[model samples]
Target: MLFKTLRWSFLFTIIGLAIAFLYDGVTGVTVTAILIVLEVSLSFDNAVVNAKVLNRMSEFWVKIFLTVGILIAVFGMRLLFPLVVVFVTAGLSPIEAWDLALEKGNPDTPGTYGYILNDAHPLIAAFGGMFLLMIFLDFVFDEDKEHHWLGPVERALSKAAAFPGVSVLVALVWLFVFSRIFSEESADMLLAGVFGIILYLAVNGLGDFFDGGLEDELDDEGERRASTGEVVKATGKAAFSLFLYLELLDASFSFDGVIGAFAITSDPIIIALGLGVGAFYVRSITIYLVHQGTLSEYVFLEHGAHWAIGALALLLFVSIGPHIPEVVTGLVGVAFILLALWSSINYNKKHRGEDHVVHV
Candidate 1:
């Protein structure tokens, strides 16, 4: 079962290594291996969330996610995205940015590719932090959510959903507080963060709007019945919109990992090849979790994943003011995942034979 599930991962890993070897012999191969591991460690929770969303999408869309989506992820975000960032931020041409990215020096020192990438940390953090914050908010505020790993806190957050736009408001307030707390030089980051929040709202709002009338029925009480919607049967335009959402979500998670990769190596090709392998594994893991019904059995796992996302969002903002080790970001996510797994085990032990469990 595992081999059948992860065969694609194996193929990609081999391809990535071969590409790495071609890039610079042993040094490229070693860096690529390290980067692949780094991406996986940093993105385990990302796999869980991707699984949750991908399970809802149709098979065609899932295939597209693996194919075209992988192209976008590998080349667009991992490689081209940084150049775009440098171009926009430093007013350099694409070629100049690429040259800058290849400049070798200590990552901590200025005038190197790593330095330029790391220098944009605040901008990257602001965008990622806001986008991820919205996702975390949406999950915690989902009124239909029954399982809770952090019971009291999650339950309270859910109640806030009663107020429309509370999530946006809270996210904005967080951005506000962060801006004030950070140095005056970082005040501009709030604008970037707000734009991130806006994009989340726009994208998710479009998704909800597109979902209109899909699963609504009147209850005998003359009120709209609560929708126990099954997996989406989306097609055409609906599928496209969902595709956009998934890609944006992937982009939000990728921001930190891509930036952090510079700390490993500044070669764009190596970064793309390395992170690409890890991304392939993430997709495979997502498929495995969905088909095996891991989320259904281990209810608290989703809870933990969202909590980890929330932590990551906050850490991104906090890192704008203080340097945070990439290891810290990766380990925090792992901790949340493990804790959620443990909680799920305990929940199963407590409720061994419930006649029913919530599927969605």
Candidate 2:
């Protein structure tokens, strides 16, 4: 099952490595390998969260995610997005930005491709941070969420859901505080943050709007009560919303990594190839979790992924001034996931023993 699921990732890895080798021989290959590890480490939590959303999707949509979605991820975000950002922010034409990228100018020097991209980091961080923060807020503040990974903390947050728009209030407060702290860029930061919040609300509200009818057709456990054709139709619409949400979410997560990749290497092609492989692996992992029902088995896993997202959001905010190591970002996520997995295993063991005693 694992091999079947990850076959594409394996294929991509080989292709990415080959391109890297041809581009710059062994050194290129090595950097690309490092980038793959970097992308995977930073996005493991993303895979878990993706599985939660993807599980509800039909097989047809799932296939779409693997094919069309991968193209968007690899080329659109990894390559084109950065170029576009530099084009707009640095007042360069798209061709000029692309040429600069190919020239592989020094990242630290002024007026270079890398320098311009890094200069735009604050806006990127603000936008991505707020988007991710909204996600974290919605997950923790969900009143109907039965599972509690952090117990008292999560429960308290959930109870606070009684106050309408409390999450938005908290997010705005955070954004305000951070914007004040970085006074020079306060206006830009605020504008980007507000845009992020609005984008999240728009996408999430639409997803929920489309999903409402589908929900009515499902029982408590999410099995369909509607005819298969009806469910498929609903799923198609709902899945498109979800697919847009997922793409945006992935973009938010990729901002830091894409920026950080410049620190490692200035070669856009290498970065694209390496990170593309990692993106494929993340997709594969998402599919694997859905196929094997991992989230259902490891009940707190979703909670953990959200917590990691919260941490990443805060890290993005923090990274506005002082540089936080990519390693630090990656480790924080892995730690949350591991702790949640351990707790889930213990819970299962205790419950299984109780069930056995009752049976006896």
Candidate 3:
């Protein structure tokens, strides 16, 4: 089984490499590998969150996610999303974007690394800032008693129109309108922000709906929960649906990563290789989460993932108005997740009455 799985991964990797080869030879290979690592690092939290949702999906859908979903993520999102963003934001025609990407004149060529970097900075900042804000608000306003802190402003906001989703929508609409009053560039940036919001809401809504249905089924103690096979089947179905949702979420998260990469290099091959390798690690991480039952074992893992998501959302919002460093954005998110993981470990130790004991 392990060999078979490895074989499939190998095949996919080769295919990815082949595509990269078609674009550029050695440079393509090297860049693609780098992108894979970058993508994987940036998306570790994504895999964990995905596992949480996938655990409730069906077997067949899980297979599809591992196959078809992976293809879309590696190719469609990593390769094409950047071009789309450039086209939309930079007002470059598709052919213009392609030519600019493939042109080999100089690394410092106009619309090359330097130009793309300059053009992409605002978008990157907008994405990062939005992600950060979402994180802060979520951490502050979380309703769970164990996580709550009382602050006057937070208290006021909490009491008055407490729906976070509504706040996000209102903010997005405001940004959209604000952009129109400003320049076209600002409008494009704001549109990206709106897209990010819509993407998050759509993915989360679908996941929640599916989760609710599964919960309902599990609650039915009669025919639905009758046997082990039945339970497994139900779990598998839920896992499949969840896997699909998770893949979509992963794609959403990749938006910034994909676009940001263009600032470094426009070579489609390099981007593919680098991001694809990163995706491999993400898949491994997701599998580890699933096998370890991290969500169940570490009580706060899910909470942390949710916090990370909220942080990412804020990061996206900030991306609209200000320039934020991608590295900082990524680090802040990772820090929150690590903190949550550490807290979960501590909670587990305490619950097991092993907190006082030194394991090592």
Candidate 4:
């Protein structure tokens, strides 16, 4: 099983690199590798979170996510989304956007597309701020309460094994608000907001819908020896859900990375390479977390991740005002997660006894 897993990982890596090479030769290969690493590193927390969600999904959806989902992630979001942003917001024609992206002979500075993105700092900041703020509020508000207004919706849908459609409503609200605020000149801002929300909802909803039922099936605890079966089931659910959550979480996390990468380079191939490389490391880290059961053993890691998410949301929301730096926003999240990890380790040491190291 381990060999098979390793082989598949290698295959995927080769394929990813091949795709990059086809797009831009040696430069593409090198850049894509970097992106994969950056995305993976920046998104380690995301994978842990995704595991929690994935354990709940059926095998079919999991396969779909790995296949079709990757395409959307690599191409739709990383490659196409930026172009769409430029066309809509910057008033650049599609051809112009394409030209800017493909412009050659400029070695020292970013291309026309990069310049456009730089000029659109306010817009990027808006997205980053809102994304960060959402993370912060989510942590602070503890919106997952069982008896809140959305509780009934959650429970009713829980039985049906679907996520509460609250994400759609949230997206709509985001569209309306941004549309009203940024629509005076063009509806691009509204369109962008809607697109972002829809992306969030689709990824989030599918994860919840698939994972909810598996968790439901694991509730019975009466028939098992050493209770090992029960523990495995419970842990499996937790791990899977965690993974799914992390995937969605990483998508959310990418809002800034995507924007930030534009600052460095505008070549779609280069951007994809750098981000994709990061994503690879993130996947590895998440697998490590799952295999090691870091969250389960540590206890406080989940709290930390949630807190970090909440902080990210707040930061994203604040970007609307255009004063915040993306680096600071990212650092805040990193600090929160690190602190949580430390606390969890300490807690485990105290509770599990000094001689015992908690393993997943």
Candidate 5:
């Protein structure tokens, strides 16, 4: 199962490494390896959340995710998105932005591609941070959700979820606080943050609207048993809505890593190769989890991933003024996932032993 799922990822890793080595010898190879590790670590939670969404998608859309979705993630986000950012933020033309990126100049220097992109970090962070915060808030604030990993804290939050637009209110308050604190870029920050919130709400609403009647068709275990052709049509529309949400989610998560890559190296080629390969593995993992029913089995894993996302959101807001170490970001996420895995295993053990008991 593992080999079947990861075959493409393995193939891409070899190709990415070869490209890196041919581009800049052993140094390129080393940087590429570091980037793969960095991307995979930072995005493990992304995979978890992706699997949850992907679980609902049909096989056809799943293939689309592995193929067309990957193209968007690699070239679009890793490569072209940075150029576009430089184009817009640095007020450069398309050719100029492309030329600046190819120059591979030092990030510390003014007017370099890296420096411009880094300078644009506040906007990127604000936008991505708020989007991610909304996801975390939605998951925890789901009043109908039965599972609670954090116990009292989660329950408390769920109780508050009955209020309409509570998540939006909290997210707005968060943005306001951070905007005031980073008053120098307060206007830009608030604008981008509000846009992020709106984008999340818009996509989420579309998904919900398309999926409105889906719950009625599903059985107790949430499997669709209906035979109506209309159900099939609705399913496809819902899947497409979900596909868009997933793509935007991927974009939000990739924003930080793309900007952060400049700190390690100014070469966009290497960044694309490395992070692209890592993205393949994340997709592979998401597929593996969906196929194996890992989330259903592990139970709390999704909860942990959402919590990590919450932490990352806060970190993004904090990073507007402070320099946060990548190690700190990666470790916090890993810690939550590990703790959740342990708790899940224990829950399974206790439940498994009870399954064999006979009732009087």
Candidate 6:
């Protein structure tokens, strides 16, 4: 199981080094290595959350997640996405945007790609933060959810789900405050945040709507069971919906990393190589969690991931106007993950002698 989990990790590392070596001799390799570590450290929470979501997907979709999905993650998000952001915002042609992305340490120039990309930081933060905030809120506020990792706090939030749109309301309120305090382009930030919420609602709504059509039987938990036949077809559709969600979720998470990569190296090729390889490893970890049933066994792991996400959301918003260390973000995520692992070990030990261990 361990080997399977790390199978692609080693491969990705090799690929990363080769790409870096091809791009910029010895220095490129060093930058790429750093970026890969940065990506993994910052995104461990993302992998955890992804595991929970990926657990429900069909086998075929899981295959897609590994195969075709890597392309989208590596190239679409890491490589071209930044260029696209710069192009759309700065009115730069594709070639021009690419060149600007390669340019390093230049001050803000009018209509330049670096200037525009940097300027979009607040907007990116607002969008990703609100979306992640909504994800955290929705998870913690589910009245149907019985597992409470934070005890009183989680229990209380779970009850709040009784109120419709509670998550959205909370997200929007926080977004408004962030827009005012953290961004000079306050209106743009606010608008982006609004769109973030809308996007979340749309994706989640579609998933829920698809779930209803997916199966005839509902288990004791009330989640639709993919029994067979038409239900199986619906499962495909549902998986597609979730796939889209996962991809977008990945995009939201990558915004900060992509922007941060520019600070490490001016070469877009190195950024893509490092970040893409790291992202591939993350995908492997998610699959490992799913296959090993790590999420079910280590109960608080999901909660810790969500909490880390909450932290990341706040960090992104805060970093919009301030300089927060990347190490800070990475360390915070690692802390939660380690804490959860410790808790899970304790939970396992305590439950080992029980007749029926409640797998919460």
What C-alpha RMSD separates each model from the true structure? 4.1, 3.7, 6.0, 8.2, 3.9, 3.6
Best by lDDT: 2
Q: Per-residue lDDT for 60-169 in model 4, tens only?
A: 55565566656666676677777887687668788887777777323235446666665564455444434433433333344443222223442343353233544345
Q: Which digits, one per residue and each the tens of the lDDT, describe model 2 over residues 1-360?
A: 999999989998998999999999999999999999999999999999999888778888888888999899999999999899989998988999999989898999998888899999999999999999999999999988867878778888889899999989999999999999999889999999999999999999999898886666556444543534343333656889999998999999899889989999988999998888999999999999998989978778888999999999999999999999999999999999999899888778767644321110
Instruction: Give residue 11's error in model 5 in angstroms.
Output: 0.6
Look at candidate 1 and tell me the lDDT of residue 307: 91
The lDDT per prediction is 0.83, 0.90, 0.61, 0.56, 0.89, 0.83
Query: Model 5 reaches what TM-score against the true structure?
Result: 0.93
Residue by residue across 177-286, what tens digits does model 5's lDDT show? 99999999899999999999999999999999889966665564444444442223235678889999999999988877887788899899999998899899999999
Clash totals, every prediction: 0, 0, 46, 71, 0, 0
Q: Compose the digit string of candidate 6's lDDT tens values, residues 1-360.
A: 878788878987997798788878899899999999999998999999998888888788988988888899999999998889888888888998888877754434655555677778888888998899889898898877646667788888888988988998899889888877854679988899999999999999999988777654345333433333222322467888999899988988888788787666657788889999999889988998988989978888998999999999999999887767788888998899889888878877887766452444
Q: Which residue pairs collide, candidate 2?
A: none
Candidate 3 lDDT over 229-291, as tens digits, reads 443333544555566556656776786677556655666657767786667657766766766
Question: Model 4 TM-score?
Answer: 0.63
Candidate 1 has a TM-score of: 0.92
Candidate 5 residue spans exceeding 4 A from truth? 213-234, 353-360
TM-scores vs. true structure, each candidate:
0.92, 0.94, 0.70, 0.63, 0.93, 0.91
Model 6: residue 183 alpha-carbon error in angstroms:
5.6
Error of 2 at 182 (Å): 1.2
- Model 2 lDDT-worst window of ten: 351-360
